[model samples]
Target: MDTGRKQNLKEARTLQIWNVIYDIIEVVVSLIAGFTANSSALIGWGLDSTIEVISAGTLGWRLHGEIKGLDERRVERRKMITLYVIAISFALICVFISYDSISKLISKETASWSTVGIVILIISLAVNPILIYYKRKYGHKLDSPALLADAKDTFICLYQTVVVLIGLLLVKWLGWWWADPVAALLIVPYAAKEGWEAFSKAQRIKNNIDRK
Candidate 1:
């Protein structure tokens, strides 16, 4: 590989590593805050962070393969596997979030005001855009579809942050108990759509590989 390409892979690996670490922190904090506040949206967001960790890890593995000078077929196979993993993770998250949110709504569960939940979500809101920008930048630099797809997942996280923040604020200030579960429900369609897209892309990669 050229020096420029190698540098891009190294940088991408660093970013993915950072992503995994940050997501681990977010998962713990968000889950704690979610349970403490009885907020389904926050809980779903935390679970989403867990999936983000998996997605980043998978992408990191593919990046490692490239950096290690894996053969072209092996690298492409790894990329396809990464996409399939991401798609499956998204599908799982969508199902989980839907069931959890719907159960909460059916049970008439009201989320209590949580300062910690609000604080963590606010921080996520501020941080995700920066992550998204760099992921897209390096994804383009490397011409990696898997990396670009991961960037889309980050964008979804940003959207979830906004939705959950609004729901938390509404619950705290306006006594809108339904807003929390509703926000979580709103996340499901987007997750399903992205999952399908990832799956389709992976299939296309597989078909091309088979042809070759």
Candidate 2:
């Protein structure tokens, strides 16, 4: 491989590794705050972070294979497996979030405001935009669509956090108990969409490879 290609792979690997670490911390903190505050949005957010971790890891694996000069077919086969797994995971997230949000609604469970949740939201809002900027920069530099797609996913996570923050504030200030579940419910359609996209992309890749 050329020097430029090597550097790009290294940078891409570093970015994905960073995402894995960040999402690990995110999953722990979000889940803790979610259960403590009885916030369905937070729980759904954490679940989404878990999917982010898997997605990032898959990208990292693909990049590593490239760096090792693996056959393109081999690398693509692995990616296909990863994409299928991601598709299933997203589907599971949709079902999980839908069930929880609906149950909360039926039970009339009010989300309690959490100082910790608010604090985490503030931190994520401050940090994620910077991460998104770098991810997009390196993604373009490397000309890697997978990296670009991952960047998009990061942006979505950032958006989800913003919605959750707004919903929590509404619940606390306006006594809107349904706001939490409603915000969480919003995530379902997006998750389902992502699942379908991933599956379709995987199918396309598989068909192309099979024709070869």
> What lDDT score belongs to each candidate, Candidate 1 first?
0.89, 0.89
lDDT of 2 by residue, 71-141 (tens): 98998887888889899999999999999999999999998888888888888898788778888988898
lDDT of 2: 0.89
TM-scores for the candidates: 0.94, 0.96
Scanning candidate 2 in windows of ten residues, the lowest lDDT window is 142-151
Query: What TM value does model 2 have?
Result: 0.96
Which one is best on TM-score?
2
As for candidate 1, its clashing pairs are: none
Q: Backbone collision count in every prediction?
A: 0, 0
- Which residue runs does candidate 2 get wrong by more than 4 Å? none
